[model samples]
Target: MINPLAQFALLLDADLMAAALQQHLPECQAGDWQVTGCEIQHPRYKTYRLAENRDRSFLSLVYHLRGRHPAETTAEQRILYARAYLGQRSQQAYTEAQANGETAIHLAELGMVGWRFPDDPAMPWLAELMDSRQIAELEQRPISTIEIVNYRPEIRCTARYRFAASETEPARVVYGKTYADERGRAVYTNLLTLQRQSVAAFVMPEALAYDAGHHTLWLEGLQGHMLTELDFTVGVAEKIPALAHALAAFHQVTPPPLLVITSQQQLKEWLKKADKLSHAYPTIQPALTGLFNELRQDCPEFEVLGLIHGDFHIDQLLVLADGRLALFDYDELAIGDPLQDLANFAADLYNYPYPVAVIDQLVQTLFTAYSAANHNQTDAQRFVWHLRGQLLTRAYRCFIQQKSAAPQRVADFIALALRPWPLAD
Candidate 1:
């Protein structure tokens, strides 16, 4: 029998996707457009990131075919467009689109929940984020140029504002992040708290400003290298101890007022995520079901909870030009088992595609350094439980992104999670 999901699979193929997009997007007729990235919410909707080959301007196209509404309300397919550009053409598109009675973004909310894009009618502040004059006023400097550093459509966009040196002020770059919701305010508050704590050995990026109305947060952009890109064999390994010490300092600080996630809530969240992924990749349903059950059964009980980077990973780490380590992205800041942060960082170490021996060494070194810096506080059983859970989460991510060798990678992670904690020495 033909797989019903095959229609959506075509979106994953760039060449075929370009051809299909041309049917709806006249710009694709120029043959200079390609699908740069994609996301699938399976059985309901799919989103594709398209870029113009010449200008490199990015746009988002979302297809909504199924929703939780009445059949008549969602029977027909809907195509929604969003662009990162703030130009006359984009404005005209939206205005004329409204005039033409095009499918409004609100109609697709059932499938596009939590998605707030730059071109969203509700996000008028997006234009200000990219506005050169507005940025200059915010920075109190003569802005030279504005460039988008990163944009995860409907989620967040990070833009860099450059200020050329004048007779007085020196050249500098400022970073800004526009959120889809009010979460940016929380992150801004968390950074302020962390900065006041003066965690030794590491620095939190200075929170420049927070626009409550626009849901945008600005920070002092730094010149640095991501820890992930550093050479592990050469000298990066030496920084591992410093990184651990910094993390210890971070854990010592009391997190700002935030939700304290309990063991029961964490279990429910993981199972829910697994259930969602199962719809996207039915092949892994059995494995996921069994693994989640094992995770719940083996869940650890903790007495004291503290501030943890709920989504701690290597990518959130940076090595500044001045040799200070910079940690960022406190959106997932929460009160939970501190081991979750350690396990999360350790799990991310495996994403480097390093040999088993190298990863083992790095993880062992990290754990040892963290223990020493934090007054020899250690819990092997609890740590192992968190590590297994983190590995399972990693497997879910690897599979969700449709990464190469996803099944084997998932199996490898699951297998590792089931094994007894190594590096006990």
Candidate 2:
């Protein structure tokens, strides 16, 4: 009679263990050895030695039957029992994947499944499938069903599943890929149509333009809850009021869960090393260095530190079909002085006509909305201080953009930041 525990240890290899268990345990079926849990106690070759449990702990040893001899037990029986004991492990992995917004593709179900990509590469098989020709083939066909949709470029092309039907009308599916420029610098963008609905509802639908040279993609899909009907030209003066309204609404909403920056200090620290603007604006080095030194001294005091849309500007706001402004791009939402957001709006006003008036209106609208929501003015002075910092920071950003080889909106920003403030006059 083999020791049950010793025999169970040999069944770590799925194939070998399954065969042994099936043979020794006549009651066990092919799928009976479902892996309940597994842990790497030690890595021996390609396998991890694991502690396993079965449904019952009472059956520690074999019992005699019919007075002939004790029921013959083998190493395989022990392995099956161990596998069944570890059944809960897979569920834990599944739960983790869901929490991380990963798309869970059921292998048994051939249809497309949805999943969010996790930062870890623990699933090598899944990684392999993401870059395979199978995905390329799926891309060529009309979008029908999708197994996974990863928004971030780091996890692009990471998906699994079979196409629903060759003849089925493909759903508008957007896929993104990031590549370094000729100089080996990275550029990231959403694939075409992937973010169209979100952009349309929040940002300007008309502003969505594709640059084949830059490889920017915009996909059209599900529109968000907020709807708008206003239409205006890009960089038009007429759009400022609507734009401000949309931005104000965005500022009114609570921040999303994923925003990691909670304070002005934390925001500054993250920006200190982002370095994306370093190549374009060498002036940022001194400005940022000075900002860091004065951060504590210059940091504004605020009564209310509600969620702020970090990059609120004319370009970031959208006029939807219902005549209401919709704010999009929550990538930088965080807890901060609302004035910081207003400052960004003020910084963008110079790009179009009615610079001072537009800036003032936007500020007023944002403040009014914020004040109504929170009913506090404890740090009004502090808000103004932060606003000044934001203006200075915007100026630095403009200076950097101007220094870029092919500055797109730098001149506009510079003009906005340099405009004489109404209070100054």
Candidate 3:
């Protein structure tokens, strides 16, 4: 049976969208351009993008998020697009957007909604959060441009711009992570709280604020850049100590806000992922099964020593000013065998476009520095066990992503998984 939501999404068909453009925007009609993609999969509104045939330039169609009509919080089922908050939630913000035509167009009630591209047309409720004196200073140095770098209604909305920030007051990045329903706003709210509390030891983008009503999070943009993009041929090994030192410092915090995952259930969950991967990709079945069987025999019961970055890799580290390294994305931060992080970091070396031997040395250097900073000797046995687990888990994930697992790649993971323990001298 055809799903109702799927049917609704089809309403904004390419032909229909082309017709709408012809009627409303003569300059942007299908006569000169074509509908190349339709991204309005959301049930609340329809959206599409037009591509000019002459130049291949694309123009985005705006979708007004306003619900069918205003509803009391009692009728949560029908509440839409931050509409329920017209009076009770953010009255001042609604008034501002309605006056500015960014939103809240009252054509005798719920009529038309859409953000004009290259304009402040969405999430007018941001004004409510920015009414403070500190934010009022923005009048002097206002944002000159707004560019949507990424957009997915249910996931997040990201924009970068000429943030004319001054030495005194800096501009903050705006973010909003959405959910199936607005009631699930606690996810980002809790994350912002965690970000605010973890600033002492970790280098991360600071969380400025989270407005539950608007489902937005303001973050202080870091001055540094992502390490993944850095060409670190010479200084790559040198930064291991900084990375290890920063990670060790972050773990030292008393009662850090994250879950501990040293339990057997966690290991079982990993095994299941491996089992599923082997079943899904029959090509790696024999090698993956052999590796899992060995892991089942070698798996150990370990205790948590400190916090571990569940997804420790070059991609998660940001190289800051003065050669300092800061970690990004705390959603995976957890308390586990610290070696879980070490091994994950080691296993991820395969991802880099570098010589395997060079990164192997770098991983050794990283673990050595980690031990030195930690002031505690690592149990080589446990380290080896986690190393194999991470390598196999990562291999499974690659398969899940449909990355072509050449015989060499599968062999590499299996070889690492079946390699000699304690990483012999």
Q: Lowest-scoring 10 consecutive residues by lDDT in candidate 1?
A: 106-115
Q: Which scores greater on TM-score, model 2 or model 3?
A: 3
Best by lDDT: 1
Ten consecutive residues with minimal summed lDDT in candidate 2? 59-68
TM-score per candidate:
0.76, 0.38, 0.61
lDDT of 1 by residue, 1-425 (tens): 23322432454444554344444343334443333323333222222222232222223334322222222332322223333222233454445557754433321211111222335444556767777887778667799987766665557777888898989889988888888889898899888887887557467778998988778898998788988788876456888898889888888897789889776777787786677556556676777787788778777755558998888888888998888898888789899888889988888887776796798788888888988987887776667667877887877776555455666887777667666566442
Model 1 TM-score, all chains together: 0.76
lDDT by residue (109-202, candidate 3, tens digit) is 2222333322235444433433444333544565544444445333445544345577887764443332223432443444455565644455
Off-target runs (Cα >4 Å) in candidate 1 are 1-5, 18-24, 30-118, 137-140, 275-290, 423-425
Q: lDDT per residue, candidate 2, 1-425, as tens digits?
A: 22222333443344453344334432333333322222111111111112242222111111111111134332221111111112244355455556765544221111111122322222323343344365457357633433443322222222323333456554343432221221111111221222332422244322233334423223333333322122223233455545544444555554444343444664464354323334334544454445444545645443456567677765555444454564544335566656667666654554444445655665555555454544543244454445545554654444322222223344333333334444332
Best by TM-score: 1
Give RMSD (Å) of candidate 2 vs. truth.
Answer: 21.7
Model 3 worst lDDT window (10 residues): 76-85
Comparing 1 with 2 on TM-score, the higher-scoring candidate is: 1
Alpha carbon lDDT at 37, candidate 2? 25
